[model samples]
Each structure stands twice: as C-alpha cells, then as structure tokens.
Target: MTTFKKSFLILMLPLMAFTAAHKFYLSVTHVGYSEKDDALQITTRLFIDDMEKLLDERYGLKAQLGTDVESKSADEYLEKYFRTKLLFEIDGQPAEYQFLGKKYDTDMLICYFEIPKIGMDKIKSIQIQNEILTDLFDEQQNVVHFKIKEKKKSFVLIKSDTKGMLNL
Candidate 1:
C-alpha cells in the first residue's frame, strides 16, 4: 500500500474506535429518573448537559461556559446551579441535602439530620450517598458534605455520613 493511504487508515481507525467507545459510555448512563421498590424509591443520573439545559429552561440562566467566554462567569453560574439542584432521597422519599444554616470557609454543600424521621420504624438504618463533581475554581471545596452523627439510644439508627467524588 502507498504510505499516504496507510497513514490515513491508521489515523481513521483510532478516531472511529474513540467514537464507538464514547457512544457505548453514553448508552450505559441513565438520563431520566428510574422508579425502584414499587415507586417508593427512585435512582437517577444527572448529566452535565442536562443540568445546564435545565438551568436555562427553568431559571432562564446558563450554567456552563460559552465557547469564548470568561472563566469566572462560568464558574459562578455553575456553582449557583449546583447548589440549587443537587439533592438526595431515601426509600423514594425526598430528604434535605443542602445545609441552609451554616457559614463555611469553603463552597461546601451540607446535608444534615442527626436523624430524619421518614415515617417507618422498620427502617433501622438509612444511608445517604452522593456523587458530585468538585468545583473547578476551588480545588479544596467539595459539592457535598458528610457530617458525622453521634451515637444515641434509639431503635432507628442514622449511620455515619459518607462523601464521594464524582468525575464527569
């Protein structure tokens, strides 16, 4: 084969492989909410593109940056949308995830409750886990805060808080 033809085939092969892999990843991800436990529980994955579009549609604001925009503006917009939209649920029930009552040095989102009553004694323990992308501007800041709860004598147990990092 000619040199030019061989080089062209090699480059196109890798590019086609990359595109296929990306397509597979997107298909694996969940876009809308999924009902579990007979509609008592729901699990959903929020994509960055969906988040940006939702913010624009709901609040008439854009969180993501433009092709040729300032970084500071983009950061500020994303932070605001994240702070507003990130949430958690247990057994298909909504629970408070953002701490509205504390001032912190960093841009940390806190979800509290020494113990939240979800209307069932059968629930011996409840675990709230969240995966959020860290802020681009503040490397030290996290999108979620998991606070430790002290031991108390009760049939209902509220376990320790667990924090996680989400890579987008």
Candidate 2:
C-alpha cells in the first residue's frame, strides 16, 4: 500500500463545516482499466466526516468511518449512496461497477469499485456521472481520472455538469 493508504491509521477529526474562507469540497476518483485483471479498478477518496454526515441524515446511522466503533451497516449505506450517485459507461453501453469495499486513512474514506470482465480493447468512448457529496455541499466537486492503455484523461464534475463523456 502507498503511504497515503497507510495514513488511515492516523485518526483525525474533520472540520464540522467549511467556512466562507474555506469553501472547497472535493473528492478524487481514480479509474484504471487493468489489462491483467480485465477490469476497471476505481478508488474514490472522500472526507470521512462528510460521508458520515450523509449516512446519518439518510439512514440515521452514525458511522465512525475509520474507527473501531464504526457502524456495521456503514458499508451498506455506502453501497446505496454510490449506486445512486455514480454511473459509468463503456462506449454507449452502461457498465456495472461492483463495490469492492472501503478503507479510511485520517479523515478520508477511500471507496473501491471494479467493472469486472471489461476488456480494454472494447473501449472507444467513456461516460461518467459522479454526484458524490453534491447533495450536501453546493460546491462539492468530483474529479475523475481514467487510464486505459497509454491514454489518460480527467474530468471535473459539479452539480450542473455532473456527467461527462470522453472520446479516446
């Protein structure tokens, strides 16, 4: 694991809210088409406190994210949230991404996903809609980076422009 992944062991609390002076809400999602695995691997990094707040508001469950006292149903809520907030497509066909799991480092929650059995050779155009955290924070921005073969591209997604298509 990378040092960033190891940072989850260091517990830290998040700011209750962003002030006018600090108004950026962001998440980074990395998607790579793995030739060896014949799958698209995804890792999304989000603030643990933000996710917990959403969970509490939606399911009335307080998820301690990286802590030992984290709710058992936390994963369930994550699954539901991602399914509703994110979507991926290969070419023009809808691609189904399976939620692998999640981990926490510091105040960030990293969620994992995989599009199984998807061959890299079959991709020409890709589409993505990532609305994570937009419901809570008006300024929430979801950044998606995709890599396939030797080509790579990225997108900045916001509430109004949550969906984007890339031609390779």
Q: How close is every model to the real structure, measured as TM-score?
A: 0.26, 0.85
Give the top-scoring candidate (lDDT). 2
What lDDT is reached at residue 28 by model 1?
10
Put down candidate 1 lDDT per residue, 1-168, tens digits, no spaces.
999999999989978886664311010111111122111121222344543444566566655533344234544554465444344444444455322221112222222212233343233333334323322111222223222223222111112222332221
lDDT (CA) for every model shown? Answer: 0.34, 0.87
- Residue ranges of candidate 1 with Cα displaced over 4 Å: 1-7, 10-54, 57-60, 64-94, 97-123, 127-168
Q: What are the per-model C-alpha RMSD values against the true structure?
A: 13.8, 11.9
Quote the lDDT for 84 in model 1.
Answer: 47
* Candidate 2 Cα misplacement greater than 4 A, ranges: 1-23
